[model samples]
Target: GENVGLHLPTLSVQEGDNSIINCAYSNSASDYFIWYKQESGKGPQFIIDIRSNMDKRQGQRVTVLLNKTVKHLSLQIAATQPGDSAVYFCAEKDNTDKLIFGTGTRLQVFP
Candidate 1:
């Protein structure tokens, strides 16, 4: 089990702007990573993904950058909006059936 206090979730973002989120992973063996955008009370949707072998991955209005050397990662959202607001989560899986999630970033859109 992980520390609960260190793993609290959610991030807040503004409307009509850009947002950058950070994630820290503890497992070195993880080889594949994905960034998912989840709206209020809904399942996660895959936005973008990157392999351990690759340093960067991009999608429409969204981008994921992975740094395996230091086990760090980031997600970038361009021109954020109210509809684009949600909880962003990063998942990692390496030959395992289950994926481990990072502390979620909650994007809040304000008009």
Candidate 2:
């Protein structure tokens, strides 16, 4: 499926600042959630994940939050760095156990 937006949203942040990337998922029954970071010429790498039973989960400098009520998911990157500059995607597994990914959001960390 497609993301909620028509165009890929971009989140610009300072090198040491925090970055928040948001995604609105379509399935209310989605039980699993994941946040992925994809650099140029590479596949998406796992950043963090949150289960439907939990509201939040943290990994390294990244955090994933899930709001089942609104079917919204968000990824927070603390102390963003130049290496954090990339396309981030949010995915969720619905009742069918199929993973559906969002359009993606580009995170640009500036000096």
Candidate 3:
């Protein structure tokens, strides 16, 4: 089965800088898109999501953008902080309605 994957295995960002995480999927049947943040010892926390019908969606300090034509997705974090450091994952709901996740990118925030 095809799955989603990240372009970068790790992303290094300075504190207070904006961070962008990229993901790609091969399945066009994916409808719902979600971004998740996972800390070292905790489960993945939902950040934001966008439906297939929508191109973009925004949260408090996060934005999720979906490009159905290119099968691409991105998550942008505004004013990234140290606490925002974690492994970020992009998930998509397949045709079967099962949530499929990417390989995940580790967000390293530096002061």
Q: Assess each prediction's global lDDT (C-alpha) against the native.
A: 0.81, 0.87, 0.87
Least accurate 10 contiguous residues by lDDT in model 3: 1-10
For 20-57, candidate 2 gives per-residue lDDT tens digits of 99999998888999988888777888888888999998
Supply the TM-score for candidate 3.
Answer: 0.90
Ranking by TM-score: 2, 3, 1
Q: After superposing candidate 2, which stretches have Cα over 4 Å from the reference?
A: 1-7
Cα error, candidate 1, residue 111 (Å): 2.4
Whose lDDT is higher: candidate 1's or candidate 3's? 3
**Which candidate number would show the highest TM-score if scored against the true structure?**
2
Residues 34-101 of candidate 1: C-alpha lDDT, one tens digit per residue: 88877656678888989898998888988888888899999998988788766778899878858999
**Residue 104 of candidate 3: its Cα lDDT?**
92
Q: Which stretches of candidate 1 lie over 4 Å from their true place?
A: 1-10
Clashes of each: 4, 0, 0
Local distance difference test, candidate 1: 0.81
Error of 3 at 111 (Å): 0.6
Q: Kindly list the per-residue Cα lDDT of model 3 for residues 5-100, writing each as its tens digit.
A: 235488999999999999997789888889888876678888998999999998899998888889999999999999998888889896797889
